[model samples]
Target: MSTFTKPNHIGRKISRIRELRNMKQEALAQALGTNQQAVSILENSETIDEDKLIAIAKVLGVTVEAIKSFSEEGMINYFNTFNESDNNFNHYNTCTFNPLDKLVESFEENKKLYERLLKAEQDKIEYLEKLLKGK
Candidate 1:
């Protein structure tokens, strides 16, 4: 038997694009004014409304058609074009941003995620303690 792929899985496409950009669900959720759990559910869905998809694409720095046509093979090929074999790729990738800035940005985002998670745990514990005291 041959395995089949679902070509029209919009949510999976969104997720892949997000991952390729080195973004976390919590970051994306904050950008979308939603929560991480909602983002998780959205990314697991098969489809999204056109308007929302457009908004998501905008936040992702891609066009809706780009997200719609995203594929693993295409992504590989796209990254391959950035290899040293392509002299043109050097100008943009080399001159645009500092590597340390990217590292710091990643660290900041991770810190925010960790803080949010810790606060959530604390809230849960407090609620459970209240219930126990009531009983």
Candidate 2:
């Protein structure tokens, strides 16, 4: 039997990318025609086979190398380097105007709209009660 080597920091990168893509494990599994538990295990750095890794990379829209390129120190150093950069404001400005930001803003607006709808329903119920009591 062949031994499986655990990927270095790929798990963290996969988790981060999944979040960035706004994907649930179940959704990703569906995209890959697999099961959520398998996706969870992959994200959590549990034992995984190469075929699973390839499927995940395809579903995540990233190269397998991109997923596997992360070293423990490399991950930390890359993030730290970005943290130390003075261009964060510029980067944030660019990201704020991205299509993803529009989607996020739209989602927030929908949430608010749903909240208002619920409140209106409650108010209507109260009004109907007052009318029934002739108040």
Candidate 3:
């Protein structure tokens, strides 16, 4: 006796599939010959035309039914049916600006701050040492 039901919402499912394929919104848009904003809107399931939906499905390598089955219950059932490893969502986790890249970028900024603080502390220690020597 299965208690699984179909999804009422489609946005989440579409988004998941897009992500699973590791396609960025911009890349998907390029494949569909559409804009990234439009792709974003479609992922959110705002209000896309039939042609757009068909194109999206084609680009995402999934059936229209898979995209349409995005309701909460449907998502739960889908996950239960599919074997979800930790890296299952890795494909869809593309970032416009990667966190590791950002961290590397800010490395110099952090280094400068640390150097300034270290110099200030050294100056304070030297000043205290001079006062003690005088006493």
The lDDT leader among the candidates is 1
Tell me the alpha-carbon RMSD of every candidate: 23.2, 16.4, 15.6
Among all candidates shown, the one with the greatest TM-score: 1
- 2 or 3, greater by lDDT: 2
Q: TM-score of each candidate?
A: 0.57, 0.44, 0.45
Per-residue lDDT tens digits of candidate 2, residues 25-127? 8999899888899777778884456787788889888878877774556768877886688587577666435798899999999999999999999999999
TM-score (C-alpha) between model 1 and the true structure: 0.57
lDDT of 1 by residue, 1-135 (tens): 999975598999999999989999999999999999998999998999998898899899999999989889987887787684677756557757788999999999999999999999999999999999999
Candidate 1 — which residues are off by over 4 angstroms? 1-5, 84-135
Whole-model Cα lDDT of every candidate shown, in order: 0.91, 0.80, 0.77
Native-structure RMSD, model 1: 23.2
List pairs with backbone clashes in candidate 1.
none
lDDT of 3 by residue, 45-133 (tens): 74566777787898888777767654556668777766665366666776778888899879988999999999999999999999999
| Residues forming the 10-long window of minimal summed lDDT in candidate 1 | 84-93
Indicate the residue-level lDDT of 25 in model 3: 86
